[model samples]
Target: MSTAIFRFYEELNDFIAPERRRCEFTCVLARAATAKHMIEALGVPHTEVELVLVNGESVGFERVLDDGDRVAVYPKFESLDVSPLLRVREHPLRVTRFVADAHLGGLARLLRMAGFDTLYDNHFADDEIERLAGVERRIVLTRDRELLKRRTITHGCYVRALKPPQQLREVVDRLDLAGSAQPFTRCLTCNAPLRAIAKADVVERLPPAVREQHTRFSTCDVCRRVYWEGSHWLRMRALLETLGC
Candidate 1:
């Protein structure tokens, strides 16, 4: 058996057991193993790892483990630039589109409300989410660590927050999306961009009071749902304000 000491940094430690978190721990490799497999075996998905160092030298996931080697792993650096070093993924996702798993319905709605291009269906299977994320280049947001471990999923995140509201804050802060928030610009239900429409065109669909009181309106291009600056809109704005977005 070969042994190596592993240290996970920052949020990467969240995946480890309480005893192993925030410190170096020895991993006994039964046989020859790649860094990727060994790291996943320790509960940290390779997707969440931005950098891996073997004995102070930058190495890729395919690096072969050796006895007495020291390994260090790090989470994605949102602010700090590690351009001079090697990153596990080919490139960072510049456009912040997202695909939420079945369990993240409320978080998906919140993302759409913030005007992000979020694709979500409660019936989406794990494989389907992986395929969509890989083919469409959408970042997968899920609570399942194993889902992020799929080799096909190049971009994904493990949502640490439990509540939908807290999850929204977590995602926003993690993605640095506060400046990009365009509230009321997307369909909360359909994930389609909202377009300004003439109040006269959608008047028949609106309630009598809404038609009489609200002149400005927007409609979802896909769902055709009408929206106006009503009480709900005001309440949503208040929510956004509370979120600092």
Candidate 2:
């Protein structure tokens, strides 16, 4: 029986039981296994892995694991660049688009408020979410471990937090998206891109005082929902800041 040493780094540690973090683990293999297989077997989703170092050389998911291999896996980097060090595989897709599972509506709203293209619906079945992510190439974000385990899911995250704020932080940090976050760029009520609209265009829909006090206005391209820099925007901005966006 051949064995390998695996060490998961950074947020990937969250998938492991507390007792296993920052420690070398011995995994025995009865047959040849790709790095990808061993990684998921250890509970880290393949989508969350950005870099894999075998011994000291960078390799891709298909890299075969061998006896005595010292494997180190890391999540997406938030500050550091390792492009020059990669032996194979390209830099991770940096687009902030996401597709969420049914149980995470609040977290979905938070992501939308933070200006992410988050596709969410309470009625989405696990298979539908997986299919959408596969077809659209959106990063699947779900709390369901079984959903993340689906082989069809090429890009996905098994959200670790129940609280919406914590889940937001976990996604931001895991994807190294802090630098790309754009708060208030999307309609909070709808996932449509907000465009600046003249006050006169939406005046008919606004309250008398709202039209009188708020000159600046925006509209959702998809939903035609109106927006302005009101108390709600301020509260959302506060939430964004609290999220370290």
Candidate 3:
């Protein structure tokens, strides 16, 4: 059997078993295999890998492995401009849009609150998610590694955090989205952009206290839900502040 040493860097190691994390481990292969297959076999999805180095030279995912090769795999470089290097993806996404799986609804809402174009449907099937990612070029966010492994999903991320708040921080830090946050610009419930509405036009819909206390308001064009700065708004603003967005 052919043997090779594999090393995964940064968050990519999170997918590996505890025994194989953060260090080189030998992998025995029965036949010649592409780097992409081998990497996925070790539990790291190809979508999460930005660069791969074989025996000190950069290689693409389709590179064939040889005996005694040393493979180094890296996660996406959010802060670095490695455009000249060999990367698995053809190009980095120019716009940051996302499609969240069923389990990430809370995180999706948080993303919407930050004014990102996020699409989340708890009823979305795996096939539907894959189709949306391909058609709309939206990044798929999910806690499921296997979902990111789908061949059709070109742009995706394996969310590492559990809590909605922590997940928000993880996504923001990973994508460097802090500067792009436009809080309250989108409908957190429906993922539609919000537009300013005349207070008098929606006065009948507002409660007595809100109608008297607030003048400025925005409405979701899709859901027609009115939003204004109230106690809930203050709480959401505080949450955004804590997230540094």
Best to worst by lDDT, what's the order? 3, 1, 2
lDDT of 3 by residue, 1-245 (tens): 79899999988988999999999999986586999989999999888999999998999888999999999999988778878888887787888999999999999999999999999999999999999999999999999899998988988878988999899999998887889899999999899999999999999999999988999999998989999999988988998898788
**lDDT of candidate 2 over 169-216, digit per residue (tens):** 888877767778887788866798888988878999998889888999
Which of 1 and 2 is the better model by TM-score?
Answer: 1
lDDT of 2 at 58: 89
Root-mean-square deviation of Cα positions for candidate 3 versus the true structure, in angstroms: 1.5
| Order of the predicted models by TM-score, top scorer first | 3, 1, 2
Q: Name every residue pair that clashes in candidate 1.
A: none
lDDT of each: 0.91, 0.83, 0.92
Give the alpha carbon lDDT tens digit for every residue of 1-245 in model 1: 78999999999988989999999999897588989999999999888899999999989988999999999999978889888998888787878899999999999998899889999999999999998998889999999999999988888889999998899999888877899899999999899899999988998999999978989999998888999999988987887888788
Q: Give the higher-TM-score candidate: 1 or 3.
A: 3
Q: Considering every candidate listed, which one attains the maximal TM-score? A: 3
| Candidate number with greatest lDDT | 3
